[model samples]
Target chain A: MNFNTDFTPLTVDPDKIYDYSFSIIEEEMGEHSFTDDQWKVVRRVIHASADFELGRSVMFTPDAIEAGIQSILAGRHVIADVQMIESGSGRKRFQKHGGDLHCYIADPDVAKEAKEQNTTRAIISMQKAVRENEGGIYAIGNAPTALLELIRLIKEGVAKPDLIIGMPVGFVSAAESKAELAKLEGIPFITNVGRKGGSTVTVAALNAISILADERAKK
Target chain B: MNFNTDFTPLTVDPDKIYDYSFSIIEEEMGEHSFTDDQWKVVRRVIHASADFELGRSVMFTPDAIEAGIQSILAGRHVIADVQMIESGSGRKRFQKHGGDLHCYIADPDVAKEAKEQNTTRAIISMQKAVRENEGGIYAIGNAPTALLELIRLIKEGVAKPDLIIGMPVGFVSAAESKAELAKLEGIPFITNVGRKGGSTVTVAALNAISILADERAKK
Candidate 1:
């Protein structure tokens, strides 16, 4: 451990680093089918993970970008599967449109319901969203159960989200859940094919949508 | 969109999923050199990211785990680089030990300081941490500038933290900062090589240390 200390970093400006990162992503990620709007979200995901494969794996429904942009512009709230997504999301962007991000996984009532029903808090959270939130964006990042439950609710005609960003990462049905999400029609969705998505990448996807909405609003 | 609706998930039980995920990780992540305590931390990282390559790249100083446990047991607060790490951390565990997790990146004062100095809020946040948070665990996961600044403060003898968990993610300066942290002597640090870490993985690492500390306290 030599404390010689003569290591200067590139640039300390946050914005510069962000711009430089996007430049690198554009240069490295060649030839994609995503439209400019969809690419915004994919670029941010790649920027967040530095994984071009995961970024390229991202799939957006025909109306995903449009649905997300309209919902965000309309001030529709966001339902995150975990606290990490709620915390990491660009809340100010949501708030600027009169919306907020909510996560009920740690709520006492959700916990009590999960314990009583022998279900995950994520499942209970989606159920709670059905009653408390409508026409909001559903962001499922950490729990396959939550994504599956939301899909069930959508099938049952009880949950009608403006958009679903389902990107749960893990074994034990993570890939299956995303596959289910991708197969669903009518409701717009943004998901990936593999078990590579998590709260961080999900947050990036949401932030990208928000940025696009913000840009559109500026026009 | 097939409204067929008959897709039940593998299990709705959260604990079962957690257990099953760990079993898979244990079986798959065979032949590691980490001690039991270190494996506890690394396992959680693998669980969070589901990336075996990233998890295997974790490096810990000789005294890293012990320093973390002692700091946590002594109820030393944690200073996170971003809100995601602070929000995602197991606050109850820290509170049980009489400590808290804090992130000053969003503070107005820190923003002002960054603007005045033409530096990132991450750098200013570290400067603030030096003044307001001594002997606390410094968990940096999003900004290489913050990690580099902390390393500078450590070398200058102005910052004395119990542990430094530096794992910022990105293409620019992320790997270089961790490399510099690895070279620092007499500091208990946990980091990884390459550009594959972020707030989620850093939170996982901190939570693992807190779990270890809690387990030891029960003994």
Candidate 2:
């Protein structure tokens, strides 16, 4: 059976694929205000989504990249709002640096607490996360409720994290949760404006930070 | 510390949030040619990505939705290309119907085999999956290589899946693999054009099919 090959893929090698992807992204994403370090994180987000619109919408605090890198180098853990982020992340990179990734959404205790409180597992997970992963990097990818809860925790002085990656996707409260995150002070965060974010894109952003951290360590 | 709440989220209730999201998607998606069943899947894809352009690009074989629903009802398992799809899926819905989710990308044997073959774990995983899960649903979300391998297996008459959800996102072979899937005949499949798909969106599509299956079973 002969197959009609309309578009031939450039290459199948993983490393070369990444290099080619970055080059295309760089060419398409003409001029940007992000620093060299910040562009790496944004480029990966664009690569993951293939949506330059969302990539350009990404916002980062001045110290967010350096804060995330330092958190990784210091062996701090990551508190993921959902298991998808944990599953999609480069865990070995974190593990090699004596850091780990944690997601409390599936924990029985969190489930029970959420049920008892008449709230979401996302909120309960963040509460449990603060007590466990001090100085951790909080990554909220899918749930807007989780990002809102984290913002509340930061405001209440109940949680202190080195960095917060708040890019939750949905129609109900996603954009609002991110807007709240932008209003937060004293906590470095990487987020975007609008309702276009997900576990895959959040994983891409976190992986970018981890890659930068790893590169820094090697140097 | 007082927080500036400019935009308040509609609701924190999970069920209400889904209802709200679907309403927004229905209102924003405008006119579409998809049937009711197909629209359900496509609507969920739009909800997951928040990108109408990508959602509009989704294509389905005439029998794709019915095939996916029948497969779920028949207790056929799912072979995921990445762990994120498995993690993000509503596994409870599938499990309640006696179906299960499987991802072989992390298996030691697949990794070792990929090293020996000088290929990706995705390719090796598909090779192993075709042997194990006959009449299963093949869900490829992250790896273009896995989708291409599955297409090869199908062309060779080695793999016979009930439904194929081939939407791998990347700059390398993503668009090409999907283009290849579109060219296949006599196979029920759900896929989108271009490099705009991911584990979250794939999970959304699968969950929509499973929901329809469950609804049918209830009736």
Candidate 3:
């Protein structure tokens, strides 16, 4: 059924926080496209997946999104617009950096457009972002379906991201999505503790990546 | 920041889904509230936190919500309600079961009354659902902040609920909210598997609980 019908702002219950989990998972699986030992200094992140199935609410903390973007910038990964399902408080955080921040949404007006065309639009956008910014970080948030399609495009030589970061912040699809990325033979994925991560952990993953990169750079 | 400014539907790039992680985490630190630990079951679930955040054009799935309620009916604890926040879909699901559901935007009219009353009407309604349905499962898909508060009220004798579930499906406040519920000493929590979970995993957790209960019954 159409999940999007009546919408409203959400009321938060702070005391209920204990019910969630804060688990992160990181893996170094074989690359999907890159060689086993190619060793590419990666910097680009994308947050392209389906929006939450529920109503709209401010889920991510600005600090978390900022941390993710900051890591890419510090690593000299030109920050591509965080490819999200839509824009909200999180987008504002990225826009503050004064860079090209593109918001990719499934335009209802273009619902008739072929899925391939929509994918191509997104791929072209990513390709442009990477081409314009050398050594830039292309980051995508935790949208597994979108990421997978993008990966297919990349493997097909339509788009190329230096590094792919998988940071989907929920319990249902996070693991499977990450696994999909892990299956990509060459790219290194930096992910969260999993399940109860939310925005804080998403940002934390970026922080971890930045720290790891710093350590590597020092050597 | 007023997070509820642009209330629109979010979209999904089917191709970009791979960019997200989909794994589950199983932590063994917490205490189980049920006497029949053998009856308990768990699974990880995930979903988009907001419809507008991703853009508009995605469909909703009631499988997660239905699964949670069914599990509780079958006797199991649910960790998350991945789609509770989608007012329209949530309400429709509730109605299908002969339940009454309502959605409020918290505009000036409702917000003023809500503030003056020192309570949210929605929480009250949800609490009523829990209290009225003894030995039955009731789930809330929004953030736990308000639900937790309602639970505290119930604990204080101001409200009552036989069972209450929290499953806000996003990376933003999901973990923090669930963590709050987990902290409650007596309440049993069945959460998602890290960032990978969504509505699918939340239902799985409930199924796990039911299976455990079934196993114990046989013994």
Candidate 4:
């Protein structure tokens, strides 16, 4: 059963992994109230993270999931705030239709300008991302400051995001930033309301949304 | 401030980032006792994560940091249990010689085999990693089962790693696995003592060690 990925031996099947993950999530979340689409997002997040608590924390604008699906189907870009978010996103499959997964935090120029501006590289990275790709998915999984900056950019009419996935984990500003993101209008968003989110969960959301898009297209 | 990377613009200088990181760490850790080298790994983890609590949680064997530095200098391979660790590792600099970073969790074969075995891809990935590299750095950041499997392989005489960097996050087995890793005689390691480790911190430690090796070579 060794699956091969780029010539390496894999011990898990992608579909089977997700299938079993949903099983676990369902078993653990007995007697809970969640819509089918909400389960689609939360179950995958649990699969990626094994953090069941996340199921309770996840929030989405009424149209956020559908917005993400539409954007993905349209081949809009997906810009992650950090490399892990981009890398774990099942990036190749999601972007198989010409969409791109981009992260500028590791870019040398971002680090340099961040220092000069005395601001977080994440803030600068968001600006670069907005400039490069408008009306794209903004996946912020590692930096609350990046999410804040994205919101700020939008407020300034400098950035347009079709859907925002904000789940940066930590203590300071992690929860606060998500709260701010949750309140943003005119921009659809999925957020975990507290400090319990991370890159893995963010990527899970991306993967689930991509899968949803594929499923919807087949129908 | 021109940090060179692919495509995305970066702004923070590497040196300045680390300097500011150390200052934040110092301010957060008002009265702690750590040697200079331990601070190197801890401060960088905090920099990468913005989690000051990590500075207190990071643990290192007396020689683990040095062991990792020497392994890189000698051009040994780095095998991360997860993609995030591999991606965050500043892998190119450490492998400026002929060393490489290997991760098989995303391997299709591993995924398939893991489903068949009712085990994690991480476990199978560890076995494959051991077969491919000896006396390399074993970097396990996202899965305790992988670290446990590595130890089992070592006990079974299947492999020998120069150093172990285990920082798997979660509630179950995260701290327990690190405790076991610390007990392995003659196998140097860097680990957090509790459930406070993650991929970012693990990679931060890896990057810090690489920087130390580069600094040492400069002299």
Candidate 5:
């Protein structure tokens, strides 16, 4: 699958914002370093974020791309670290595939647990997400604490995820968490190198994968 | 009201993420240009978003900071262009000051109107927001079209707002809309120079002003 063939803009804008963004990003990226599927995500990320830094920051384990797509194709769960990520994800794409998009940070129970535990609500949200869907695709966009908790749970043999898209933004643990994610052996993850990530970047990757799955299925 | 006076670390952690981020940004932003209150907003914007692009991009009319603080102090409404901005904004701060935050992008009524009018839902959301709260603080984070529409309404005297925080993040009209904002002579606003703004940046500004108001009131 070539980069251009794998995905198309879903909107009806005559200006083709996504289309022109793709072309410009490809020009700046210069070389074809990523696989076609992986490029699909990277292109959409720079397109969505308008930051060419992602071209250098985006790190993907070999199987991470395929894992996200397969999960999307199968209509698996996408559990986000925060409501912002869940809100920014590709809505119509998920609707078409019957995707289960969830973010528990706003749940009354999660808030209660966080207050009782003296921990961040994001940590409680991750614990609840892993408890509900062990093999689901996880997207962490807002909280480094959540990503760190997810890593700890996976190490303790507590839960497993099909894929992890870790793009938490903040100076506190944001860069360190991505470095930790890069070191993990078999989690199959997509992450960046530094503190330059947010829910928008996380959702861009998700929206890209969902778009890929949507177009691929049509064929 | 120096840069270092108005804000201290909010959390207990000794490793101050916001503090260090502020120092680095000050170094990057060489000369002190903004007013003390204005610098508070700019510092927090760079803190929340680790992009120095905002230093050059952030645009504020002379009285925008004091205007936003005054509106927040008075418990005016805050209408956002997207849910992500609405969700990421510090909620308790608003409640403490009796501020009302709203986003109608996903509302069924907005959806119905968008379908009926053949326009984007964000335009309809802005229309509804100005109709409901004539002196509200308008926060636009994810859509240039929404910002453009808001500017149009204000230009046409169809709507009025206390302040406009326009930071839509994309390539299309992001820069143009901000340029438009700078042209509005009397409309108090906080905007940026380019496409390097989003829900995070928009909420960061809102959060900064709210925090300033909250702390200033405590004194």
Candidate 6:
């Protein structure tokens, strides 16, 4: 069985994580609600680690997971599937969350597969996913070129998204990559200040939104 | 009385608080010895408070003073100065610090006079000092236009300095301003990673260089 199939049981945790993450999505629509502790967790994950397994294990608290889910429900889009396999290679994996919000877990080896027949199919799938879900935030965790292509497509009117959050957590190209995302003007977006921002910060912002939503629901 | 002359004789601790708040200087060559505590004191003064009086109160240990003096003795250049002032329309003040890296405090109400007459003369005098001190670092703290002029002079082969450290530590126009300094290729330079850098980081780098020089001298 492939890693995806072998890890099928683990997907339940990630699903729960997602549900928990986006639990307060509605509250994040009005304003940002990240506390200092949440910011610290987000910062740590984004700056130091790139592996989702490691980031998932260490950074994702129950609160963080729920907050992430809330963000999606509140019209924020979150994508966290692309993984770095090498300097310039990646893979795309598809996961169904059964929600209006589109999510994909691109293969960790997609970059290597970019030269293969499956590359076109993957890109097309992503494009379709984005197009099918318009007027919502698009959160890409660590896909630079892919995110860039997505943004270009959206800008060209091939697809439309309300917001694009580039939350790639790495050195060298990370800051430059986010700067490139910020250059796209039509959609409102938020990023960590300079190199300090990472996946953790991205999730923190979402978590803050979720917390706000939960509080509102309580009221 | 001349600003320097009038202020120099005042029975005040040269290390005590004065009118200049936080100041960041990037010295390419200098040997200043500072205790860990002293370094901490300097860092805190520059990072937290924007009051010049607090800056004036900062007293470097004998080692720190000597370290700074040694940088001048060696063949290195000081490229930037970042500081805060409370009295002027511009809350921040960045100027070229001559070998005489001392603060001249004037009455808050006399800011216009200081800007029009005293500060102008000080800048001119500092520039002259840079010319006279053949082996000393010519400091250029957060003056973007002046930094551009300096770059132009260097490129034209008029002013050949050993190194330039760009240490502007504020949010306003920092990215563009640093880009100007960083654009100078083929020159050995050190700067903070990004916005997190300020006077403290710049000076920290200088202090590190100073310690290295001191170790060499002991050899």
Off by over 4 Å in 5: A1-15, A27-29, A90-99, A115-117, B1-31, B90-92
Please list the C-alpha lDDT of all candidates, in the order they appear: 0.88, 0.89, 0.36, 0.78, 0.79, 0.39
Q: For all candidates listed, what's the TM-score of chain B alone?
A: 0.94, 0.95, 0.41, 0.88, 0.89, 0.45
Q: Ten consecutive residues with minimal summed lDDT in candidate 3 chain A?
A: A18-27
Off by over 4 Å in 3: A1-89, A95-106, A109-143, A160-163, A168-189, A192-219, B1-148, B160-163, B167-219
The best candidate by lDDT is 2
Locate the minimum summed-lDDT window of 10 residues in model 5 chain A: A5-14
lDDT of 3 by residue, B1-219 (tens): 221233111124442332221121222213333232321222122233221121111112223333444544453322222222222123333343343333232335545655666555444444443444433443444444444554576567654333445554443344455665555544433433122223323333333434443444456
List model 2 lDDT by residue over A1-219, tens digit each: 112242234354667678878888888799999999999999999999998999999999999999999999999999899999999995787889999999999999998998897788998999899988878899999999899888888888899899999999978789988999998889999999998999999999999999999899989
Pairwise DockQ winner, candidates 3 and 4? 4
Error of 2 at B199 (Å): 0.9
Model 6 TM = 0.30
Query: Native contacts recovered by candidate 2, as a share?
Result: 0.76
Candidate 3: interface RMSD in Å?
11.2
- True-contact fraction per candidate equals 0.76, 0.76, 0.10, 0.17, 0.39, 0.00
Best by TM-score: 2
Tens-digit per-residue lDDT, B1-219, candidate 2? 112252344455677678778988888888999999999999999999998998999999999999999999999898899999988894677788898889999999999988887778899999999999878899899999899999999999999899999888877788989999999999999999999998889998998998999999999
- Model 6 residue B53 CA deviation in Å: 33
List, for all models, the DockQ compared with the true complex: 0.70, 0.75, 0.07, 0.20, 0.38, 0.01
| Residue A50 in model 3: lDDT | 13
Model 2 interface RMSD over true interface Cα atoms: 1.0
Q: What is the C-alpha lDDT profile of model 1 across B1-219, one tens digit per residue? A: 321253343367666677777888898888989998899899989888888999999999989999999998998899999989988895677888988888999999999988998889999999898899769899999999999999999999999999999999888788889999999998899999998899889998999999889889999
Q: Write the per-residue lDDT of candidate 4 for residues B44-99, one digit (tens) a residue.
A: 77665555665677877798888888898899999998887777665688669578
Binned by DockQ into CAPRI classes (incorrect, acceptable, medium, high), candidate 5 is acceptable
Best first by lDDT, ranked: 2, 1, 5, 4, 6, 3
